[model samples]
Target: MTVQLNNGFLKQQTGNTIQIDQPVKLLVVNLMPNKLETERQFVRLFSHLSLDVAVTFLRMASHHSKHIPEAKLQQTYATLTDVYDQQFDGMVVTGAPVEDIAYDAVDYWPEFNTLLNWRHDHVRQSILECWAAQAGIYVDFGINKRVIPKKLFGVYRCEIDQKTALTAGFNQLSMPQSRHATLGHINDPRLAVLASDPEAGPVILASKQTHSTYISGHPEYETNTLFNEFNRDREKGLPIQLPKNYFSKDKPTNTWQRDSIHLYDNWVHSLKKVKV
Candidate 1:
């Protein structure tokens, strides 16, 4: 997963060379069921950047994971107390599988709220993905999520709304999305919609005041991520559909990786400008 930043399309924007005197402290609060797989996915994306990033994985103290073994969690992950006093250059809150339930009803909702508040003060830039995106908008702005009749599961074409650094190298972007809930009508003037799709609604939102970015789709998903998910659900006899625009001749492919890496690269580039 070595990404040549000097390449034509993926070339980094012209700017001062990012001073790598110290590795950027990146914290990923992973709420996905498969911790190790999620970690590898994110690390693969981060590894593409030219910057030296020291990534720290965080787990919730209140909600015990059913999928990952407790010993693995104990051996590899950190709780909030471990990094409570530390500030990070960037942080990522991954989407959890508990989208159907109310935010308050989740077991670790209270603890998550505490973490979000702490991030507001400590982190320079934070990305909230999927469920975390909905939660962030609800916490920051009074926007609520509405349940769509069917799961919005597929790779949808998104139109970039603004020419911010986050969306610097993109025109029309294709992103992978899997979620049961979509954000309701947003009325907050403080929040800016960055990218959107006709079916997926608001796919990206950014808040200048908080320095927070919310992404409704999983741009970090691997090439076969949606395929694996679809199979997993189908095997369990759950209702599932073929991921749109993801397969070529009804077969899975890795077309979205280039754009995904480009988006993440832009994010890392933005972190370099932060005087944290």
Candidate 2:
């Protein structure tokens, strides 16, 4: 998706005179090979928020990216080695298309594990999405990811577990998810379900004690995200399930893509307010 940002949103302040609160520097660990798009997506999500957010992109140095342009990576992303022991107010680990492989089988698993452990100790809060969420469960609590019989693709409705701080302002909000892996068969004692579907219950959200948040869905997806993915996979002859309830008339061309800025904003705000 081509993203364009409005310069009007940025306010000019003289730093030589005085500076206010420090901008919340977030280290976005993008497992998605397309570093350009991932960076733009994150910037788009957090740009509208009132908080000051500065993002630094981190990519796995061990795995060679095939989807993203090599030039883009050299220009925009940094390897995991570039950021170690650096304190970040927030951290994000994005999902990738590597769910088909075993966690340890992935080339960067060792470095990835190290990054996750560091986040647990340093970052105030962390967000894990889709496959990353599943991997996190495995790394943190020895939980495993199970392949479902079918791909759970679509705009699913999640009923909020109102008691949690993450759901403080959101109740019965609809989120977007496009993935083939699930955690239904995983046995993990530390995992907690913050919201669930009536049909697919136990979509884990947050743990009891950790500041990490796991979202099985891609709440940050653009309106055309699913549609684009569907077409791409179809062209590639990859087996992909249709996104259920994504189109207004259940037609691919009629899908109305929308932003999840509100949800993203709420999450960032919640992280700031959450006391560890």
Candidate 3:
């Protein structure tokens, strides 16, 4: 069956959408403030996949999101308890703008921990992004994120390590980074750096034992995402700098689009070989 997508580029993808016996079920923990926009961004990539896939957006029940109305969240998003008995082909815990604060201090941290623990047994493959990456690593591997003096904001070229199923096609790719912290030297023998940059540190990390992937940057970001963020901070009279390698003339080029799509596509295709 053909699935209708959210909006914008996603709407045009209906014709090209893949048909299969069963869609790969994916659970995404929506930690970003703009839920709808994040949906559009991710669904856009999922639409390009060679197999059918279904995405379920999950939200934290403990914390009240001030940006989007609670009424809307309840109508669409699932809570941790809602999917406790369900099994998924893959899971993704997204990044949030809570890098400066300790993980336990966050209002939803307790429940977030519960969800993370659940992911291992119930989900086939899992990915943690940005702040979530730090949290997951600390919990699973005891790797703590260190705060940098300045926010590492902008597009950066990351060198891809020896190819794995998840990063097979690319040697090196440019991904956007927007964070206040970075993963320090990884001493754990199980954890492998799939991609890294001198300035951005470890951008993509993976561990076979955990069956999880961690991405430190925003590869799924829309071309204008960093641009919009920079303008917003500047307008609020906050300390902000122009993103490095992001602008040509006046607009930002989408340097990471192909790589981001490639990464997600690989993850979806690998689902068949994974057992929940």
Candidate 4:
């Protein structure tokens, strides 16, 4: 969220360059335990886009995050109250680790819902990634996410359907999915499935009525994300299997990173210019 002022950026503004426009304002609601890592992943993709973006990392005000230090949490993250009066060009709501828990049972459920309700008006366009995507779908379309028998973790090739700006120029794309809940049967007219895999089903969905998009995979995940997660689960004695189509001889090749970058670029391009 912090920007180091550089010569070129300053020159562009001071010299009145024709190409520069107001920086895109983006709000990221991070729900993961490793906040710093999540921040890194999202920021990496955002950094690749052509537009200059100003990002705000927001945390649930009511929930206490034990993973990050209290001092650092207060310093680095924003409470919903901090930016309630503001509006943004776009918002990114990341997935949480609480897929198995019922939505109402999560400690910050009320606060999360409050944020989503507020985003409907304040954010021009938005993305619901991973678990947040399923939650958003349930709230918006009255659909429920069923817990799958196995964790759907790995790189998957999804066939793109409806050619919206979000999925334009791609017949199919590779995505990294790491979730236990799946939208069993999406029989709603309000939402359109942009891409689907045989096993992963709907990988991307856009609301026909709203400016929000829902993604079932974690395109922001780095190459070793699933690798680290696999080890972490093993250390804790949690039941987990090797991620499908992810590992090769104990190493992972980044097959989905470029596609992920383009995916986010498309989302950024979909946003209209908003105030600084």
Candidate-wise lDDT, in order = 0.83, 0.69, 0.83, 0.82
Candidate 1 per-residue C-alpha lDDT over 70-100 given as tens digits, one digit per residue, 9 for 90 to 100: 7766656788998899988889999999999
- Model 1 TM-score is 0.90
Q: Please identify model 4 stretches exceeding 4 Å from their true place.
A: 1-21, 273-276
Ordered list by lDDT, greatest first: 3, 1, 4, 2
User: How many clashes does the backbone of model 4 have?
Assistant: 0
**Cand. 4 TM to true fold:** 0.90
lDDT tens string, model 2, 1-276? 111221111111111222334566677777876555666567667767766666666778777777766665655567666667577777889898888898888898998888887786778888898889989878877777778777778877778764565665656667777777777643455666777776444554777566788888776676677888888999999888778878766564322123255556666677667534
TM-score winner: 3
Question: Candidate 3 — what's its lDDT?
Answer: 0.83
Q: Least lDDT summed over 10 consecutive residues: which range in candidate 1? A: 3-12
Worst 10 residues of 3 by lDDT: 1-10
Give residue 74's error in model 2 in angstroms: 4.0
**Residue pairs whose backbone atoms clash in candidate 2:** 223-257, 223-258
Q: Whole-model lDDT, candidate 2?
A: 0.69
Question: Sort by TM-score, best first: what order?
Answer: 3, 1, 4, 2
Rate residue 149 of model 3 by lDDT.
92
In model 4, residue pairs whose N, Cα or C atoms come closer than 3 Å (at least 3 residues apart or on different chains), thus clashing, are none
The true-versus-predicted C-alpha distance at residue 16 of model 2, in Å, is 20
Off by over 4 Å in 1: 1-21
Better-scoring candidate (lDDT), 2 or 4: 4
**All models, RMSD in angstroms:** 6.6, 5.4, 3.4, 5.2
